[model samples]
Target: MSIKITKMIAKTHCYIGQNHPNYVIIHETDNWAKGANSRAHATAMKNGNLDGTVHYYVDSQECYQTLEHQDGAWAVGDGKGKYGITNKNSINIEICVNPESNYYVAVDRAAQLAAMLLNQYGWDTSHLKRHYDASRKHCPRRILDEGLWDNFVKCTKSYMKKGTNAGSVKPVKEEEPAKLYRVRKTWADSKSQIGAYAYLDNAKIACPAGYSVYDWTGKNVYTNTTAKTGTQATKLKGLTPADLIKKIGPLFTADQLKTGVLASVSMAQFILESGWGKSGLTQKANNAFGMKQNLSGNTWPGSKWDGKSVVSMRTGEQKKNGEHYTITANFRRYPCIEDSIGDHSAYLAGAKNGNALRYAGLKGCKDYKKAATIIKNGGYATDINYVNQLCRIIEQYKLTDYDVKAGNTGTDSKPAATTPTSTTTQKKTFKVKVTANDLRIRKGPGTDYAFTGKYTGKGRFTIVEEKGGWGRLKSGAGWICLTVNCVTRV
Candidate 1:
């Protein structure tokens, strides 16, 4: 809690002369260079001739004040006037994300520093803004990628309340009902579910195109029809995988709209976890996602199951040491597939691990890959290839099409890569700094070309060739923007 603040104020020429700060801006140094910590940045600021600068540089161990709080730094000049947060009005805090430093620790330290600044200025979280907020450039890539901005704000608020950063924050608990019923086409196909009801008759009455009603433990209690009346489209190569995507598209889309969960990513989980709705657990318990009732239970008020109904089944699990074992565990069973899907969405939006949502920022994530990564990093699964598996499923099925259309919403629907009218041709191999968080890799050298589904991260990469202001990645990934704000010669 007692973060050491080391002062290394910059020369007058390095930063603007004066600043009456009204807000605090958060940023991240996209430098993975070795030893690029708080002190390193401070050292750079102390000397003259710096192209850009910030008020403070924070790492895991300490915070470095690079400039007096009154002086304006070069950061966020491009983002001026958006929040009325110009360089003159904002004090920038750059969190070091170098390879050698601890990212989570750095984030905490930054949050603490922000809290301290808020204390100094007597301002609230409304005073905080990501550098991206102003410039539209992805500065704190990880925070946006993993959806940590809200948690960061909450963490800062907690620090402000506690007055001391000694203990962690915890989410408040809520209440739940005793039982729930699910409505679905089939017990095995969880994605085909339509609704979850607190009462059995209501669930039965709400069942659509499927005369099936199951209990929380996945036991089929009632069935009025023996056949599926809904039409089924021809499958690709006779595969059942994601074949039900069309049937359950609305369910996931609704979830995305209401909860900010990426429909594509959650649909991919339905494929992997339920084995395309053909898994034994799905068939019997209607638990498509291997929904185990963990110790935390359902933190969401909407999903706070009474914890009375569960199906015991043998499940395979892996260890960090590449070890695998099977054990009988109690998995939360859905009365219908809809309940499972709804409950899954509720869990993501509401479940927390001591003040942080289990899948923080997943509720409204637009990028499927980022959502998948958040799920994987949030410890949703043990499969080392979990993210890749989910992403493959999403891209392969074009599940993103089901995501809510907010005009170029999903990652698959990336914003147009505008070509530069002025072209630059360079033959020699060189490195360029990739600042775009979602710089698409095109199969050809222009926006008209098809996307390779690959993207450039915030870092440096080798460009083997250049044409029309685009650089061809030496790794054969694809061509990316070489002249746009995203890419610049390192």
Candidate 2:
């Protein structure tokens, strides 16, 4: 499939392109207004109606190139600051998702065009970035809001590998698959007994002097003393209702706490869903909120464990007729309590979930009772009395105190507190030379960020700001992780 690039008439005074474009910035038109598409955007650019310019406009049908690859477009709002990728070093591509157009189809074509550009420029997926990365204006709002960024990247990578030939490869040794074996309780209580040994011999050795060994699937392998597996299994760490509140009270992010989600509601939901973190799935998997394994085609990102290894436990579902029945379903497993809390916050926010517009009213609401009602009405829980139960939990334990501490003043009159900033001070600008192989300068501080360009051996850049060991390159070239010793100060 070839991407048709329609060029527009050059405006004499428009942006000048860079000779070597190093970054690809993705954006959405967000103009759901009538007749919005590649052609309309191209017309706007041609007619001088648009102030900012982009290199390409991708709709469901075709891609329009309004500016040459050598010219820079003012697509990212960052402008030509010290970080000048917006108009100096990056090619901007906008996807058309008007009210009438199919956004999914537009995004699909956009990804294809992005892959083609990457291949043409000899760039990798690391160079692909959203407008949000350049400046957190939420430009590609729907895409990031719906958690489809990963899916888009996956699509790009898939297209990148399409025609590459594998040719001949040397035979490689394969390692044994990891194994999980269980030890009976008599050998040691399940809590003390190491769960899931990597080897059967290790499990046998760990079975104490007399207990039997069983596979993780609970199949009996051997028996020593009494041949009877002890019936008692050690309980996982159990927290009292008060302890649960204290444990999770301070864990909420400032953004989440400010989003109008009541801390009392959050804590109550955790208690109700996790059963004070004592439920089988909660104990085994640390999934405190009982979130489902996946949403549509999207699973929770950055799961430490194999997401497929889920804990299926019985849950109560209430029908419209007020009848309750137990059913077994797989739930997501988190690596730690923090992950669970973070996911819970994202779920309530809904924007990070696939349903970006759903439960929007729950965010930033001051009334805990109203927040619970909104959650219930938004289909968050099946129980009819879910709101009442949440309210009861909040009242029973005075969880409102935590909400108050979270900066919810009970009245919606005052603006929420500003997001807390890191205490680390940025060091003064200094020059540095690239010391590592092909060090990438990213749009942000973390590896999760998109690369603006790569600096090979001996390449130098001026670091404008430093935070968390990441140096922001001068002239908006992007950021480099200085902690890895990739660049040495000169």
lDDT (C-alpha, whole model) for all candidates: 0.67, 0.61
**Tens-digit lDDT string for candidate 2 (323-350):** 5443445677565666666666666665
- Write one digit per residue (lDDT tens) for candidate 1, span 1-490: 3345767888654345678898899998877778988888788767764678888898766677888877888888886677577888889999898776657657866877788788777888899888876676666766654345655777677667655432342211223222346667678887556444434554555453345888868888777663532222111113323336556666677667656778788878876666456455665556778778784443565773456766555555657753444344577756667677777888877888887778887776788888888888888877566677677557656777777767644444431233222224556799987644566688966544655646786789999996644678999888885533334566
- For candidate 1, what is the lDDT? 0.67
Candidate number achieving the greatest lDDT relative to the actual structure: 1
lDDT score for residue 461 of model 2: 78
TM-score of each: 0.43, 0.40
Identify the runs in model 2 with alpha carbons over 4 angstroms from their true place.
Answer: 17-19, 77-84, 163-490
